[model samples]
Target: MRRKILKVLALAPFALLFTSCEKKISHEHREVHWDRDMCERCKMVVSERNHAAQVINKETGEAYMFDDIGCVILWFKEENITWKDTASIWITDVKTSKWIDARTAHYDTVHQTPMAYGFSANEKKESIVKDSEILNFEEMSKRVLQRGR
Candidate 1:
């Protein structure tokens, strides 16, 4: 009986470790503290509330924060990061500070951003700027990538 008890005690640590290793494999939006969190792309403090953006790698669950949507695009293109469908892209709505899926958010190119990308995100489908065209995530990314090239 003592030998059996010792064996169980020896396996307790391994069981604990195995159970603890079962972490959820998903990305979550992290809270950005203005003037505290720096942009991963520009290395500038993320001060903008509405233009803030975040990208999360699906496989690694690593998050990359940006001060502007333009910065996110530039970073992805410059790093040649693969934009996988499983990855999460978040952007702050211009009207509300709430996070929205970058792919579904409406993008306006006239609004001034922290990185001077002149792009902003909105939940509405219509473009707020009269002369500027509204773009989806792919269109905006292409526009920024083309400009970088």
Candidate 2:
């Protein structure tokens, strides 16, 4: 009995460490395996940490990952998705590498993005650059659609 209690005490820290090390994914965004999870539209690996995009169905909570924002836009057109208007779109901030709401982020059109849309998103306009063209989500989407990639 004494030996068993000592063993349990010795292993308690390891058990706690394992449990605490588990990553906690939030409801807003799902876990992504960079370079492993294939993009839904372009079929490219989402290896670009700053250019990856995610679209989630508002009702069903299904997430579609893309290697670039351009792929996400083209995917909606190709699939004829009806839930796009109500979906939650997420993109990585080029400066911080943090996930941000794509619809509300400011975009700069001078990056070597994965799909070559030349657009990169950031939460703050000042972070993008000084004297560069900045665009809202709607404007960016329109420009990307016009490109028709």
Candidate 3:
């Protein structure tokens, strides 16, 4: 009886640890506070250190976030994203974490993220394109070299 009790006690900590380590997804509409330095979009508590963000049209304040670039593009395409009149688009560089234009983003076919696209901030790096020229789905397909389904 003593040995059985000790064994149960030893296993208790392991059970607790596993439960604590599990990811907690909230289905309720909880208020989210988003900081650019922390989360770029959705404003959820982002534990993923590799997260990135983009804001289109600072004036309009349109923005989006992604766990990875692929997720960002996937969300955009999946939702058939559309922009309002007189707006700009911006995206964060996974490396530098700086905001850049969305238009000039360099699309890489092969990346950890399927929608991996990046922009250069300065002359040294190619920044993502801003709202200087907005492209619709038709134009984007040609730029990314993929057909919009």
Candidate 4:
């Protein structure tokens, strides 16, 4: 009827306004998406067990994938010329397939952990040091190994 058509027409503008005001979620934080064949860095087969890699991005969903923890740092320090907002480092547990934040992990001087970076081969446990305690490559090298060649 004409009344029904008028009711729908009146509601249409309000509906469009609500839809236009809806907040859009960014895809920047989505998990790493890539071909499952090989690591984009080391050229090794992407293994779900042994070594692992991850992609980090922000704002615009620009992802950068790597083969090892070392590679991740190396890529950030070298390859990625593009601007990045924030980065998340994904480290696989030596015993478990679970991923942990590498930026906030305890480093052991005796136990060898898989995919460990630099002298952190001796990682004791996961996230033992807390995020604030972690140091960058240059600083960690000086702290863990001392300043030298």
Best by TM-score: 2
Give the residue spans of candidate 4 off by over 4 A: 1-35, 48-50, 81-85, 108-149
lDDT of 1 by residue, 1-149 (tens): 99999999999999999999986766778777888898997899998788898888978878888888888877876787776456798999886878998888888877777877676888887637577788888888888877762
TM-score of every model versus the real structure: 0.80, 0.81, 0.37, 0.52
Q: RMSD per prediction, one decimal?
A: 3.4, 7.4, 15.4, 6.7
Per-residue error for 94 in candidate 1, Å, reads 1.0
Local accuracy of candidate 2 as per-residue lDDT tens digits, 11-117: 99999999999865443878899979999998989999998899988777789999989888889988999989888899999978899999999999878898899
Which one wins on lDDT? 2
Q: Could you tell me which residue pairs clash in candidate 1?
A: none
Full candidate order by TM-score, most accurate first: 2, 1, 4, 3
- Whole-model alpha-carbon lDDT for candidate 4: 0.49
User: How many pairs in model 2 have backbone atoms within 3 A of each other, for residues 3 or more apart or on separate chains, i.e. clashes?
Assistant: 0
* Displacement of the residue 126 alpha carbon in candidate 4, Å: 7.5
Q: Is candidate 1 or candidate 2 better by TM-score?
A: 2
Q: Which ranges of candidate 1 are over 4 A from the true structure?
A: 1-17, 83-85, 126-132
Which residue ranges in model 3 land beyond 4 Å of their true spot?
A: 1-51, 57-62, 84-87, 107-111, 114-149
